[model samples]
Target: MADPVKHYQSEGHDALSAISQAQRIAFAPMLFQASWCLREIGVLAYLEDRGKEGATTAEIASHCAIGEYGAGVLLDMGLGGGLCHLVGDHYVLGKVGKYLQNDPMTRVNMDFTQHVCYQPLAHLLDAIRAGKPEGLQVFNPEWATIYPHLDALPEPARASWFAFDHFYSDWAFQQAQEHVLGYAPRTLYDVGGNTGKWALSCAARDPELEVTILDLPEQLALAQPRIEAAGMTARVTGHGVNMLDAEGPLPGEADIWWMSQFLDCFSHAQIVVILKRIRQHMKPGARVCILELFWDRQSFEAASFSLNATSLYFTAIANGNSRFYHSKEMYQCLREAGFHVEAEHEIPGPGHTLLVARPLPQPS
Candidate 1:
């Protein structure tokens, strides 16, 4: 594999270019908001429909039901941000504008950032100083993290949060399911199984397979209805327990333990503690499968950039201590928890890495 560090090893831009980049960063929030408004207000879509012919500022404003001045200002920012281009007096949708208007990934990311992270990020420095998710006060001052309040989050916030959470993992689930089912495990434990989506999917694939969801009580409550709706209540069950609580009981008979994009929600020290707790209860010869998007293992620099930016969400909103991790840090945590990695598989599409591990042999 090519060294990921090569991307960041040198300053690639001259001073003039560097200053231009810095200025862009300074006004990035304004550009992002302008781009979002253009898409949401139908300006980009109207431009897209106009195609090569494009549309004049008055025509766009009339079609989108906004003032011509408002349209012109946003269009000017869009041009500067590379979201649109001006042809004489007309504006046409650029590649970036088209992406913002129609790309599923971009749409999901934009909404997630807007509804979930944007306002909370204002408290990022406070979160850093307090070593807690201080920004969570944007919703409720008493809540420690966003997980418990996920279902309670208002309309687009809840929708966007789940969409963002599931988008990357959902794409990789098919390949991951096939890989895990290869072991023919009768019982699979899905740690951090929010709403039991993975559990339902796996149960549907294998009739005899019994799946258990281990998560918070609230999440289990949400999953119960879905399990009954799927008519898999018999095959799928919930175990309400917080992984953060060391004293929480973990079932010992499962053939495989699955944690999908779960461990990264925890601090390194917390991860080791959680893993060590699971190590004590895992049955002999059982496998633990961890699926995560390690920033360093990404095939593209853009994927790395997205993952790194997401780390701030964890800090300011989700949980102050945890961030998307590197593969090496996870490996170290596994080893510290008395387990060893037996295999690593890179799930195609979403750039997720699955690490399969087993407990270290007991001393003779």
Candidate 2:
């Protein structure tokens, strides 16, 4: 097999360029904060409105309701960070600034990073040393993971958290819906059905389909009302049980078992256990479909960079054991759980790959 990481094998930058990159990394937090302030304080918006004409520092300050000194300092960092550029004493929004101001993905990522991941990241080293989400204590001292406390997170954190979560998966769902429903399965089990978003979407598409959401009771509590509101109470149901609990009720028989962006929340061993347990109860010839964004599979360096950085969030704020996986790792997990990939499809737009697998034949 060709090397998956061939591009990252050597130092591609000259010494001066390498040092410049180091400086950028060293000042990343400060620059990020400056960019945030630029957006929140409306400097970016004002500059964007000015277009090519741009605006002087004083004009920007006057419009944004801040002192010229405040505006100058933030705009200075913005220039340093390439969020804006000055031409003839006028500041114009740069391409980076435009994306920061306008891109939905960028907006969701920034909000999530600022509101949910920032404070927790301070304890990243401690979490690494302890092999636990030590930073999660910032939200609740008693909680071991952030999943259960998701709904109760304060203010913008809750909103940003869900926005970031749904932004990636929801878009992919639009493309994945057709392929999954194409199986023509009468019953589908949505394992780790966070908020029943996938289950409801599928249920809405196929009138004959009956969907079951398997997830934590806390998540189930949140999903049940949505199902009721959608008037899917009769065909959709919640199975509130932790997959990690070995003694928990096995998933009921289903023609299709779907796990979308779910197994990444678990360690390799945990994933094997969960899949093995599902294998025990899945009906004969039932198929398992997994939707994931493998870091190594991304065509763009930026997308891969995003996925790799997201792994740190898993370590510091999530379960502390799981991360965005490479395709090989997931394939190994499937093999260990007695399945083989029968087909793979790349969903258009968001770079999500869906794997369809069936159980290996059992010994007599």
Best by TM-score: 1
**TM-score of candidate 2 to 2 decimals:** 0.97
lDDT by residue (tens digit), candidate 2, 93-189: 9999999999999999999999999999999999899889988988888989988888988988999989998999999997888888888999999
TM-score of each: 0.98, 0.97
**lDDT score of residue 270 within candidate 2:** 96
Worst lDDT window (10 residues) for model 1? 1-10
Model 2 misplaced regions, further than 4 Å: 1-4
lDDT of each residue in 148-225, candidate 1, tens digit only: 789999888899999999998899999999889999999999999998899999999999999999999998988899
Q: Relative to the unseen true structure, what is the C-alpha lDDT of residue 70 in candidate 2, on a scale of 0 to 100?
A: 93
Error of 2 at 342 (Å): 0.8
Report the Cα lDDT for candidate 1: 0.92
